[model samples]
Target: MTQPGIDAADAASPRRIRIRTCVATRERHSDEKLLRVVVDPEDFTGRRLLADPKRRLPGRGAWITPQLSALETAEKRRAFPRALRLSTAVDTGHVRTYLAELADGPDIVRKTEH
Candidate 1:
C-alpha cells in the first residue's frame, strides 16, 4: 500500500503554516495565536468591528494578538483602519467583548508528562 519512496507522515503534515504580524505589538506570531478582524459592512455607520476567529471572512482583514492589552494598544494607535486599508473608522467594542468571553471561559488543563 506504500509508494516506492513516499513517506506517509510527510504527506499528512501541513505544507506550511501561515505567519501573521500583530498590528498592535508589531510582533510576529502564528495564525493561531492571532485573531483576524474585519470591518462590518452591514453597519450603516461603517465604524463597527467584527471578530473573525475562523478567518473565513472576505475582503481585507487585520491581525491582532488575542489579548486585551494588545487590543487596547491597537485601538489607542488607531491601527485597524490603516491595517485594514479602510478610510472609515473602526469600532473595536465587539472584539473586546469576544476577548473578554474567551478570558472568562474555563481553562484547559494540559496533561503533564511524568
Candidate 2:
C-alpha cells in the first residue's frame, strides 16, 4: 500500500522544524529587566543572545540574563554552554557593548557612578 510517486520512506524523512523555549531571565538585585537570549529547543542546544523583542530564530531555545555580571560569570565558568550542552561561539565583546548601552539607560543607571 504505497503512493504512485511518493514512498513511505520519503514521508518519514524529517522536515525543517522550529523549537522554542525560555532558559532564564536576567535580573539585577532580583528586580531589573536586562536582556535575554533564545536557546535551541531540541535538547536545548545552541544559544544566541537576542536583542530584539521578537524571538524569531531557527532551532530550539532557552533564555539568558543580559547583564554584564551574569554574562561574565557565564563566560568565565562557561555554565551557559553547559546548560544547553552545545558550543557557544558568540563574541563576548558584543555582549559587553550591549551591557554598556543598558547601563546608559536611566532605568539601569539608578544614579550609580560606575
Candidate 3:
C-alpha cells in the first residue's frame, strides 16, 4: 500500500539525521559528530559522567563536541552539570578517556583545518 504521490524508494530510504548543538563550542553538527554524555548510575561514589556513543541510555543526556579539546574546555567551564540540569557535581574524566581512545583509534577520521 503506497501513497499516491510518494515514491516507494523515498519511503524506504533512511530519514534525515537531526542536527545537535555542541554544548562546548556552541556549533551545530550532525548527531554522529557529537558525543552524548550521561550520568553514570553505577558510580555511587559521585556524579560521574560517561559517554553514550550509541545514545541509547536512559535519563538526561548532554551533547558535546567529540573532540578531546572540547571535552576539556567543557570540564574547565563546568558545563556538564548545567547542561545536564543537575546540581550534583559531574565528573568528565571517563568521557575524556573515551574521546581520547576514539581519537587515537585508526578507524576514526581526524578532522583537519585548512
Report the lDDT of model 1 for residue 84: 82
| Model 2 TM-score on a 0 to 1 scale | 0.43
lDDT of model 1 at residue 48?
87
| True-structure RMSD, every candidate | 6.3, 13.7, 6.6
Each candidate's TM vs. the true structure? 0.79, 0.43, 0.78
lDDT of 3 by residue, 1-114 (tens): 678898899878848998988888889999888899998878775488889999987778889988998987887788888888878777787898899888888675789999
Q: Write the per-residue lDDT of candidate 2 for residues 1-114, one digit (tens) a residue.
A: 566887788767846443322233232332123344445334243344444335565543334465567667767766556554667564445456767787677554357678
Compared with the true structure, what per-residue lDDT tens digits does model 1 show for residues 42-113?
887778889999999776889999989999999899899899887877788899999998878977799999
lDDT for model 2 comes to: 0.50
Q: Model 3, which residues run further than 4 Å from truth?
A: 1-9, 12-14, 107-114
- Which run of 10 residues does model 1 get worst, by summed lDDT? 6-15
Using TM-score as the measure, name the better of candidate 1 and candidate 3.
1
Better of 2 and 3 by TM-score: 3
Angstrom error of the Cα, residue 16, model 3: value is: 3.3
